[model samples]
Target: MSDASRSGVTPRRPPPMAPMGKARYRVMMTLVALGLALLAGRIVDLHVFDRSFLQGQGDARTLRTDTIPAHRGMITDRHGEPLAISTPVVTLWANPQDLPEDDIQRLMLANALGQELDALNERIARYAEREFMYLQRRMTPEAAQQVLDLRIPGVHAREEYKRYYPAGEVTAQLLGVTNIDDQGQEGLELAYQPYLAGVPGKRRVLKDRRGRLVRDLAMLQEAQPGGDLTLALDQRLQYMAYRELKAAVTENDADGGIVVMLDARSGEVLAMANQPSYNPNNRAGLDPQGLRNRAIVDVYEPGSVMKPLAMAAMLETGDLPLDTVVDTSPGWMVIDRFTIKDIRNYGKLTLAGILEKSSNIGMSKLALRLDDPVVPAKYRALGLGQSPGTGFPGESTGSIPAPVRWSSSQWAALSYGYGLSVSALQLASAYTAIANEGRRLPPSLLKLGQSPAGEQVIDPDVARRILGMMDQVVEPGTGARRALVPGYRVAGKTGTVRKTDAGGYQEKAYRGLFVGIAPVSNPRIVTVVMIDHPRGDSYYGGAVAAPVFSRVAGNALRLLDVPPDARDPES
Candidate 1:
């Protein structure tokens, strides 16, 4: 061929090497080569595989993780009566960054989210750069549903529990309330949080397209409900006592009032009532003053009600005898720089006469003799300056200055209840030692498997001697004339102390206090009453607080079927 012709035809180069070309052979060889390739592919897929694409697509098919909320436990009283309960509350949450694309739904949601708009806006503005933020928490179920119906993307509802009070302010001082997050904040709820609150459980669940729970992945551990409480309280007695306490505060136009009832034999508190009280369910509306459980929270000079405790301490230490006598002037006496005065004085006062008259001068002198080195030891033995451990949190350790802290006026003032401060309940408990035949019982609000046999701090004989003097105050003296219970021998004392005002004492605003035991034969209850800042003309305990105690005790005794120590012949 000519060179030109060969170049033009271009060498056709042996079919440029078809890789394995129809296979050097037969149809069986070709099929066998295909089979081998298919097997190789299968082996690679089964062992040394890359499943990234498949896993990514599978994840999109369903959820990657599951989560579930734990159920809160219930709280009940000693008798199985529900005092505090946990109810489901729904809260709205959002991922504003992923706000729904639907304009109409957004508008509807914005409107349903009224009232909390400002707060919601603030929250959104803060996390404007973030992925998610809670819009509203502690929402009512109805409100949560309305928000959910908007069907906004990244917007959802979560369930939590809120505390509820069935008895409301009636049991507020003892039961206390929990915060919106179901955490204990005060009272028995706070003190016993560990046992009363349950451990949270975890659950994993798969959600559907609509965010509904479709599958439960796992339940890590079964949550245990909170154990129930058996209180020392009787509901009937609590209501009656609160009613009386409220009425006294209202009638006397006093700033506040407190009523505490203790079972005489057992030191268990049967009822604790404080007026100007707040509803735990509506804590948002409560005023700061209304939140105080005055019986155990506020400290005051217990006034003349402390006279008996002072005198008992005196006799217990042999500082004074029941028959001891002193010269008491008309109604006053002069001490060093501070002149001491009495409500009224007797010409010649016996030791018992000092108690009957509530003579400040007499108590002051008696206290002078009681200034033994053992005074501090005696006070400690009485449990002063220590918490009552009554299962009520934040109960103040009523102030009792150390011996080194007491100045010259302090010794005398301590006897008249000026230098020392004590909660109304503490004074009530001290009187309990006197009425209880000298055993200093520890006060308790919890239901005990057994009550400790209290230590005998005072001889029963000395205690009864003190009790007799106190009983006299009730019979022919200021207390009995006011705290009159028809059949019951109400042994108690009246107290009137000028309250400490701003920088100094308010001579006008007095704390009227009374503490007593009823049904002398088998003392069933110790009633303590205190009225703060009474504006009425009669502001003394004999006028304002004791009457309330009589009314409350009368009803409580009858309701508890303690057999009215005596029925009001007038009633």
Candidate 2:
């Protein structure tokens, strides 16, 4: 101001303003141009180079790829009866993060899912970080729809299939049961899982904020439905066997029972039933013991039922004939501190008489005469000590001790159906060799288009003679009298095996068994019955198991319309 006042008339006035300096103006324009260039590069990079990445991030929020479930195959009996079927079901799931926090909505969702509100809240809290969680699996379609109608956020339903068994408990152990994911858990279902479980397909879809599928994005893959399975079981015969086995178990006050019926000509398992069986349709209260297929899996000392097999093996050596007599006087013999006895001494007994009396002494004598490895070899040839090759899960290869190291006492025990074990299926299949006239066919649970090739295990003539000897078991005063059918020529053996406990054989604990072939003239079927721990005075095979065989086989034969082979005296 002093300089201006001195230069001009006013001291506050300053020199006149001049144009902006070139350098300063250039600096300002350069900064503005740099900012614009940076902005333009950023716009190009976002719209071009990183475009797909950003799109993926955005799609991840609302788009989902789902699984398209394939239906499982149907399991049918020989007559086309549905043993197992698959029905459409739905699974409810949710995302905890997307679920509403409102208490009322949460309560409604919990009720729909059959869960308590507190439990649901706790589950949600526990899975708070998870994007998906199962609410209910395998719910009925209507129930799942009820859940979806509520339209709670983050809740969803997925289509699936559930297995249903039409035969219920009758075929429970045979057909087995599946899991909530339609995977086989046991029985034939597990054995054939590869064929029964189809490959699941995939799909891509868009979902809304509430987790509902809004549109089909793309078809990722096509689901392949499983193939069907036809078993050799006859539904009618299965029902009958179940009924008879259950009745016998109840009547004898026994712990459990099993019955297996096979087509003698084909080795087809026409009927197999076990008591303490569960309902495949409802597995809520299933006991592990009840899930066992006893006929195919349970092993036991077969008692006198093995006598015939021993006789057949000895006869094969040409050293013993059907009618060869053995002196059984005094009824009992002792070997190596083990006493082998008969009910009574019949001075001398032919092979047939030994079987008829269920004579342990006579059979033991016969077994002792055989050389080592003879008995076990014959048993192996008859499908004992090996799996039946039916592809059944947990199929047992019954124990048969090698004869190489066996003592005379052990051999004798083997003769009278001890010192070894045999499943009901193995015993029945062994008898089928006799019924099939020496041709032993491997057992099959699946229906066969033709009779399978069989191994010739015994002489046809020897088998016929054994059949005749077995027929004598059903005659009056024989051990298996109760196994007689009024109008059929029945051939069978009776067994009363002492159960082995921790120390040794328990006298009162016995397994009664009967293995028979009906219409012995031609031998159409082989039926085997085993009753476990019969608790009454009459625990013999003839009294407990033979009656079941009589009822089941007799009725089964008639139902199949096989003409009676025995002449009716009244007619």
Candidate 3:
């Protein structure tokens, strides 16, 4: 330093340094050691003890488990015609925190979504704390894609399903519709919901800071799609029945109507259509009444339609034979001040003649002679007073009262179809016994692999005789010529019952009903037609209801390729 200082210009004065003390040196060295130790301990704690918690916290923001919506099941007719199906759709969701805060960007998003700007703002504010919310649910894929093309942050489309009914209103009341969540709410859909709904799947996914999905990590569970359901309903027959029932209701200026056709051998419902039907696809303001499947739900006192059943009951007593005769004086009689009358004076009628003439007096005498429980018990065995067991929701077990005392008037009223209520399905099923030679098979809406074992409710000979008597009613009795098919022998009964109110029966309000089986020699199709409150020229079942039976039964028989038993006389 002295040499440099002498040679160079006062060379660099050694930077002045403070004197070093032992205590100060030790203090500085101790501080440096403490600082390194604290850092090393922190690193160990963070990488070892707190590692999992830290990782989980970080993943809570950057990773998410998403649900993959499963597709709902399909509903088809017996012939594989689609009744209801699920179509692919998209749902839009958002993370409120990740959404654009700029008013202009938000306004663009609102416009793209067809929502008001103010509404969008309110919704975002409401969900400010939530990371997820649905923007729009169940939108068409193309429609949802249009908005996603805006490239808005936090906006995402999720795959989902929308239900579509191919048969539209034609199958509406039967197949029913799903809710926005794709859950069944009514009809057969509601009955089989457990089998129709699928399990949703979960998957872990990576998300960017803006909460937009980047990539799928791993599937936590696989989506399980719902199973398909096949019904026994025949679409062609259903359409025909719907068309005819609609026309009959319109022509008669009736309130509403129901037409139910059953396969007599298998007890499978072939066609069931109700009036005042609604389009399930568009149920924005549907009346709940329009959704009623009258064939299985609504009940009515089926006037003379009960006569055949009563006759069956009487014959089951073994006290009355088909050829036995009874005197019907003046065509009328009195019981409990209730006047039960026939159409006119058919002074004396054989048991078969009573049904042929639809004689109330003759039927009253027969019922009064039997024990009260006999008729009610026989009706129960014939599937009346019970649900048809079609597994249909809201199925009515029609009321057949067990009166404390069976009065003469009660017996008289019961004889001609009063004092008890029966649904169209019940009546149709009851006649299945006569149609199937005295065996009443359990009614089914599912296509059966084989016919179920039947409960024999009546003797084969009596059912045959009753079938023959009903054939006479259609051909030369009260069913009127209008019920006749040109190329088939029809067996049926007519019923005209005055609709009752809280007070009493309404004279002007009547329900016309016809229950029939076609090709009586070898019965195949059994049909029931009901018209409520028909106006104009006639309100009788023979006039309003029988003709509908003719059209529906005639078409159904031909559609089934049931060989016509009644040869065409001209041919």
Q: Which candidate's lDDT is highest?
A: 2
Q: Which residue pairs in model 1 clash with each other?
A: 78-230, 78-231, 474-480, 487-566
TM-score ranking of the models: 2, 3, 1
Global Cα lDDT for candidate 3? 0.88
Could you say which candidate leads in TM-score?
A: 2
TM-score of each: 0.84, 0.93, 0.91
State the C-alpha lDDT per candidate. Answer: 0.76, 0.89, 0.88
How would you encode candidate 2's per-residue C-alpha lDDT over 79-174 as one tens digit per residue? 998999999999888988999999999999999888999999999999999889989999999999999999888988889999999889999988
**Candidate RMSDs in order:** 5.7, 3.2, 4.7
> On residues 518-558, what C-alpha lDDT tens digit does candidate 1 reach at each position?
87767888889998888877888888988988898888778
- Candidate 3 segments exceeding 4 Å error: 1-36, 125-129, 567-571
Model 1 residue runs over 4 Å out of place are: 1-68, 110-129, 139-153, 208-214, 369-376, 405-409, 476-479, 566-571
Model 3 clash pairs are none
Higher-scoring candidate on TM-score, 1 or 2: 2
